[model samples]
Target: MTLKDRIQEALKGALKRRQSVEVSTLRLLLSEIRYAEIAQQKPADDSKVLDVITKEAKRRRESIDAFRKGNRGDLVAQEEAELAVLMSYLPKQASREEVVTAARQAIEAVGAKGQADKGKVMAQLMPQLKGKADGKEVSDVVSELLATR
Candidate 1:
């Protein structure tokens, strides 16, 4: 099944199970996916839907951080629950070692030598890591490796 189809199935299952939180989370994800489709002037493919899902997941993570900083434990828990639901649809995340290994290859391919080449390395690297690795983490690993040179 496509990612969208899987989400629809999950939404139906959530409704049947009377899991209100999951139903709502799935609804929100569907809405985001629709918006993304509209923005692209066509229906999103699985990877595009995954991108929308990933973006929503990232936003939820940021909100959880902000809520924690503001001492809004209640909001934090809600966001965390929502994030968990969203993540159920995404592919498993890449490990740090995998990201570092990819970054090393990217640096070599781009001939990136130091901090000034950060942008160059990232541009060449992100596509390889997209949806699997966090951009900031990849950048950090690339920067650290370059620093030692």
Candidate 2:
């Protein structure tokens, strides 16, 4: 079965189990996938499904951050619950060490000598790390590594 199919199945299961967070998250995900398909004029492949899930997960994380800053504990908790449900559909995230190692390789491949070459390194690295690591985390790691170079 495709990732979309798995998500659909999970949505059905969540509905059966009356898991509100999972049910809502899955519904939103399917809705996003449907929109993407409509926009692309074709069914989304697994990678595209993952891209949608990743985008939703990122949105949840950002919402959680904003809610925390606003001192809205209830909103933060709700966003966190949704994020957890979204995360279940994503692949295992890359560890900091893995990101660091890959960043190092990318830097070398791109001949990035220092901070000035950050963009070049990122251009080379992001595709390799796509869906496996958060872009912000990867950027931070690359900046730290470049600073020390």
**The candidate that achieves the highest lDDT relative to the unseen native structure:** 2
Q: Native-vs-model 2 lDDT?
A: 0.93
Local distance difference test, per candidate? 0.89, 0.93
Instruction: Give candidate 2's total backbone clashes.
Output: 0
What's the TM-score of every candidate structure?
0.94, 0.96
TM-score of candidate 2 to 2 decimals:
0.96
Query: Over the stretch 1-149, how does candidate 1's per-residue lDDT look in tens digits?
Result: 78998999999999999998899999999999989888989988999998988898899999999999999999999999999998888878899999888888988998887889989989998988788877778888988998986
RMSD values, in order shown: 1.2, 0.9
lDDT of 2 by residue, 31-104 (tens): 99999999999999999998999899899999999999999999999999999888888889999999999999
- Which segments of model 2 are wrong by more than 4 Å? none
- In candidate 2, the residue pairs with backbone N, CA or C atoms under 3 Å apart (3 or more residues apart, or in different chains) clash, namely none
